[model samples]
Target: MVAALDVGGLGMDAQVSITARPEPISLDPRRTAVVVIDMQNDFGSRGGMFDGAGLDVAPIAALVQPISRVLETARRAGLFVVYTRQEHNSDLSDAGNEDSPHRIKHRRMNIGATVEAPSGIRSQILVRNTWNTAIVAELEPRQGDVVVSKHRYSAFFETSFDTILRAKRINTLIFTGATTSICVESTVRDATLPLHCT
Candidate 1:
């Protein structure tokens, strides 16, 4: 028989009982890294062009407090920290024309909500960097934090995230941030392996 898993921030936090388990979980600081995703103003709904997109960002905002606690733990353990942003250029030409590497579907509309910004994320096929694409302020990065720019949802796609982790001999990954069903899920699918974190 399998046990029901309690998930989400503070949802199943107190459910973990390692002492009752056969084998305890262990983490090796030298082999672990933290990957933070899309905690930007756009998603955080603080001061982005798409702030009025009609989605409640409070849940994510609340999650950040606990996530920051975990982040501090990672820092204390001397683990690596990586951040991802989905910002793209307005010209669409910055990534490419039709076959541009950036490949943002409605490039203009998403960035600061050009003309179609009022339309909401209806045709938001591809998203990229804009003035509001930086990570959220709650869990802001400290000095030496690795920042990566990703055109796609996965931070690993055609980016230096993998290279940097490998260079540091990082095998375990601690992923945290907003939009769990979208960006977070995408990263997990795109990642080459399983991630280990609290």
Candidate 2:
């Protein structure tokens, strides 16, 4: 005869042991989406914003190849792929006083100031349509992929990210990108909110 399995919680005086089993989840590609966050030249390339500011790009650059592989695999599996880019207007009109401190600091350090990008556009770092704001070549978005531009760390803040996800009927999101503690984490936290998809 099989022994009875007590699956409920036991009190301190109880002396029973329980074994937990791992369950494998089958993912439906149609309902899943991959969110690639801020994998741009400004944060991952040499002579870019972060590098020009004396920040090491090696760590962030290391994620490129792996993320590219993931993008390829996800596309092959027919999963929706979305890329989020952080950028501001050339005239700094979109950036209010909230980012003034950072701008002032970078200006003081002679970094992140207006510079001539590879595209021949004279703009500050992460300016839209400039080379520094473009997604890295290794993981560029394909024809069917979606691209969202955001000015804040959290992609959901004043962005069409949620609307696009809902339009595609996406239920699960896999986030992959650079600077795990900042933009990536912020996006993840915001994505966890209850989405009221019509």
Candidate 3:
């Protein structure tokens, strides 16, 4: 379905129709942004959080190339690109204090435990500025792309993500990343809501 917006700015129109489930969606680069969510080492690489917990990283690892291609295409089309990292504060303050459900869940998973990354660096799982929280080398955010660090599964929750999109006058989003049923799905659902952007 084509839902064209005014998208003022001479010579900025570059619309394309992408065949998708449910219907064919029209994309106008001027009004759209591509959100790459939680494609971090802790979730997609060996010796990181998911791998340390015995979860298979193969599936997540396989996505790097495809997502890279998508990002390249988006850039060429002049679409705004945003990358999100799921991470917590180094002191664990923002991870929820004193047996909160958030902290409990993380504890169960040993979320902050130190683990040796494939790069031979020992880093705390999902902690900001650590190897585990960094986006994989293959999909690093290029210059001119925005990066946001989110503590929760949904990037939009208590984050500047929505505000950033609104400031860019973005009305359409293309989401791609790890854990389709979790972080990715959560962000996509949140994006559907109307925000009273100034």
Model 3 lDDT per residue over 15-118, tens place:
67776788977767788888899999988988778888888999999999988888877776677999999999878888887678778877866887777777
List model 1 lDDT by residue over 1-198, tens digit each: 001212223332233222236775444555667788877766675445445555577777777777787777667656678888876655444355655534444344344244223225332212354435656767778998888887666787778877787788776666787678877888877675544212
Task: Provide the clash count, candidate 1.
Answer: 8
User: Which is better, 1 or 2, measured by TM-score?
Assistant: 2
Q: Which regions in candidate 1 have their CA more than 4 angstroms from the true location?
A: 1-23, 94-109, 112-131, 193-198
Tell me the tens digit of each residue's lDDT in model 2 across 1-198.
001223134343433232334743344556778889999988998867988778899999999988887777677656688999988877656655645854554454343357776666675687788788889988888999989998778889889998888888887777899779999998888888876333
In candidate 2, residue 81 scores what lDDT? Answer: 89
Cα lDDT, all candidates: 0.61, 0.75, 0.83
Positional deviation of residue 158's Cα in model 3 after best superposition, in angstroms: 1.4
Query: Which candidate number maximizes TM-score?
Result: 3
Which ten-residue region of model 2 has the weakest summed lDDT?
A: 1-10
Q: After superposition, how far is residue 100 of candidate 1 from its true place, in Å?
A: 11
Better of 1 and 3 by TM-score: 3
Stretches off by above 4 angstroms in model 3 are 1-11, 196-198
